[model samples]
Target: MFTGIVQERGEVVALDLAPDGADARVTVRGPLVTQDVQHGESIAVSGVCLTVVASHEDTFTADVMAETLLRTSAKEWAPGRAVNLERSVTPTTRLGGHVVQGHVDGIGTIVARVPHDGYDEFSISVGKDLARYIASKGAVAVDGISLTVIDVNDSPTGAVFTLGIIPETRTATTLGGAAVGSSVNIEVDVMAKYVERLLSFRDVEKA
Candidate 1:
């Protein structure tokens, strides 16, 4: 589990085939961070939790799945592409962000970036199927950074939402550099999905 708070920005040093089709070795650019990570420890890379496979002074390796790649923007990453990194929280750690399972619901693209009076607002568009799950002022995680939806709408292009980002966020994470048409990993609020599922069960029982 994670809190969707980005701790550091890492770069993709390498990504290549592993022994199995389900796994690949991802060498991250943040070597100082992963220098001491224990083998098998879980780390959230771009909102996807992956277990450590190997480590060194400047790089650590994680095994990634094809499903994860297909569901997120991680696959588009190249050797120099930056990624948001977050270490899994322990029992004693503070929950700065909301509970995130590192499970991406789908991918979203930045449709527009607008500068408001003070804050910057972003328009992120996703698939039509995910429209039902998104709600105005709801919680969503993009690239492992937790943010609230300022607005939601269905446009001729697709399902889109507006997000308000502060100056601090603009400097701390990779989102600061995000632009229109850029793909990002998205995780919808897990609680909302569960509530919807329970409501379906109630309907079945009533019938």
Candidate 2:
């Protein structure tokens, strides 16, 4: 489990694809997150849970399976690409942010970014299937950084949500450099899904 708190902004050192048509391996330089990381431990890279296959002084290698690449922006990762890094929560860790499972529910597109008062307001497009799980003022993880949803709008095309990014968040995480068309890993609050599932069961019991 992760708290969705970005501990550091890491750079993708390299991404190596296998010749056997298999998964790719990604090497990231994140001294902060790797300070005490061990092999096989989980790390949240841009909100995707990756296990460390190899550990080094200042970097670590993690294999990206085909399914993970297909479901996340990891396929677009290249050398020098900025990525948000977060270590898994420990027993004594503070829950600074909401509970995040490091599972990317779906990819979201950056629709617009409006600068206001040294901050940026981002509008992102999400899949309509995941729209019901999102709510105004709910916690959402974008590129591994936990953020509160400012508002949401549903349309025939898709669901669009707005987020208020502060100056600190803009500079401290990869979201600062994200462009309008960039894809980001998104994870909605798990509690919302649980509530919906329970409601469905209740309805069935009433029948």
Candidate 3:
């Protein structure tokens, strides 16, 4: 579990994919997150929960399975790419953001960006499967950074949701350099999914 608070903007040192591309090993240089990290510790790298297999100096390595590659922007990761890094929350950790499992629900594409007085609003398009869990003023984790949804618009193909990003968030995370059409890992609020699941059981009982 995580709080969706990015502690470091790490850089991808290397990525070695298997010949069959079924899985891959990625090494990231995160001085802060690696300071006390140990083997088997969970880290949210760009919103994907990865286990540390090896920790050396300021870098750590983790394995990415095919399922992660299919559902996240990890498939496009390469050397020098910046990634958001957040260690798992401890019992005493402050809930600065919300409950973020670091389990990316799906990939979203940045479709539009508009500048505001002191912030920027970004519109992202997501599949209906993922958008169904999104609502205005609700929370969503984008690349491991928790953000509030400003609005949501349903479309024929999917849905486009807007977010307000402050200067602080833009300068501290990978999203600072995200451009239109860029792919990002998105994790909708876990509570919404749980609520939907619970309601389904009620419907079954009513029938």
Candidate 4:
């Protein structure tokens, strides 16, 4: 588990894709997260929970399965791409952000960006299926950085949400350089999903 607090911005050092396109191996250089990381430990890389398969110096390697590739922006990752990195939280860790499972629900695209004096507001579009899990003032993890949804708008086909990005977030995470067309991994509040599941049983009982 994680608290959606980004520890560092890491860079992909190498990416080796299998010939069959079934899976791929990636090596990321994250000095802070790799300092005490061990094999088999979990690390949230761009909101995807990946296990450390190997570690060397300041770099650690993890395997990306086909399912993760299809569900996240990992397929677009290449050498030199910057990514948000966060180490799994311990029992004593503070929940600075919110409960983040590192399980990306889907990929969202930045549709617009508005600059402010001390901050910026970005509008991202996601499929309605995923948008149903998001709400205004609620928490969402974008590329492993927890952000509060400023607003939400629904369209016929999809939905868009606005997020206020302070200067600290811009400099501390990869969102600093994200362009309008860039893609990001999004993880909605896990509690919302659990509540929906529990409500489904209530509906069944009503029938």
Candidate 5:
């Protein structure tokens, strides 16, 4: 489990596709983070739960399968690109952010970014596929960073939600550099997903 609190911004050092055509190696350099990660430690990389295959003081390598790559934004990473990094929560750690699985629910695109000098409010496109889980003032993870949904509305294609970004958020992760039309990996609240699953099961039982 992760708290969604971003620890540091990491630079993509390497990204090589594995031979299986379903897995790839993702290496990142983050030195301020020294938590003694094991070979199988769970690491949240831009909202994706990647198991560590190799780890060191300043770098760690994780294998991401094609399913993970397609489900999240890891495939969009290139050498020198920036990404949000966070270690899994420990017993002694504080719950700074909400429960985040690092599992991308679906992909969304930035529809508009409205700047008000100090901060910006961004509206993005969320479709029916992802809209059911979204609630006003609820938590949403975009590119691995936790954010609150400001508003929501339905469209012909899907639902559209607006998110308010503070200056700190704009400077912390890739969201700061995101532009309109940019694809963002989204992970909705875990509780919302579970509730939906329960509802589906109930429907099946009734049928």
Candidate 6:
């Protein structure tokens, strides 16, 4: 589990895709986050929970299975691509952001980026099926950074939400350099999904 607090911005140093395209080996340079990391430790890389296969002084390697690539924007990963990195939280860790499971629900695209007063407001489009779970003012994890939804606009085709990005957030996470049409891994509030599941059970009982 994580709190959606980005620890560092890491760069992909190497990406080795399998010849059969079944999996990939990714090595990232994250000095801060890799300082105390150990083999097999879980780390959130761009919102995807990946297990460390090998740990080094300033870099770590993880394998990305086909399923993960299919569900995330990781398929676009290449050397030099920057990514948000977070070490899994300990029991004493502060919940600076929100509960994040490091599970990417789906990939969303940045539709627009508006800069204002040294800050940025981004509008991202989510799939119609996943949009219902996102609510205005609610929390959503974009590329492992927790952000509040400023507004939600729903349409038959899709759902778009606006998020306010302060200077700190822009500099600390991958979202700061995110460009229009860029894909990001999104994880909606897990509590909302749990509540929906429980409500479905209640409806079944009522019937």
Against the reference, the lDDT scores of all candidates come to 0.85, 0.92, 0.95, 0.96, 0.87, 0.94
Over 15-94, each residue of candidate 3 has an lDDT whose tens digit, in order, gives 89999998899999999999999999999999999999999999999999999988999999999999999999999999
Best-to-worst TM-score order: 4, 3, 6, 2, 5, 1
* TM-scores of all predicted structures: 0.92, 0.94, 0.98, 0.98, 0.94, 0.97
lDDT of 6 by residue, 50-140 (tens): 9999988899999999999899988999999999999999999999999999999999999999999978999999987689889999999
| lDDT of candidate 4 over 1-207, digit per residue (tens) | 999999999999988999998899999999999998999999999999999999999999999999999999999989999999999999999999999999999999999999999999999999988989989999999999999999999988789999999999999999999999999999999999999999999999999
Candidate 2: tens digits of C-alpha lDDT, residues 1-207: 999889999999999987864579999999998998899999999999999999899999999998888888998999999999999999999999999999898899999999998779999999887787779999999988899999999998679999999988888899989999999999989998899899999999999
Ranking by lDDT: 4, 3, 6, 2, 5, 1
List the candidate 3 regions with Cα displacement exceeding 4 Å: none
Instruction: List, residue by residue over 54-131, the lDDT tens digit for candidate 5.
Output: 987889998888899888778888899888888888899998888888889999999999998778999989788999
Clashing pairs in 5: 22-66
* Per-residue accuracy of model 1 over 3-114 as CA lDDT, tens digit each: 9888888899988865564556688877545766899988888888888888888788887788887787767767988888888889998998899999988898898999
* Pairs of colliding residues, candidate 2: none
Please give the clash total of every predicted structure, in order: 1, 0, 0, 0, 1, 0
Question: Candidate 2 vs candidate 6: which has greater lDDT?
Answer: 6
Query: What TM-score should be assigned to candidate 3?
Result: 0.98
| Model 1 regions lying over 4 Å from their true place | 18-23, 155-158
Candidate 6: 10-residue stretch with minimal lDDT = 169-178
TM-score of 5: 0.94
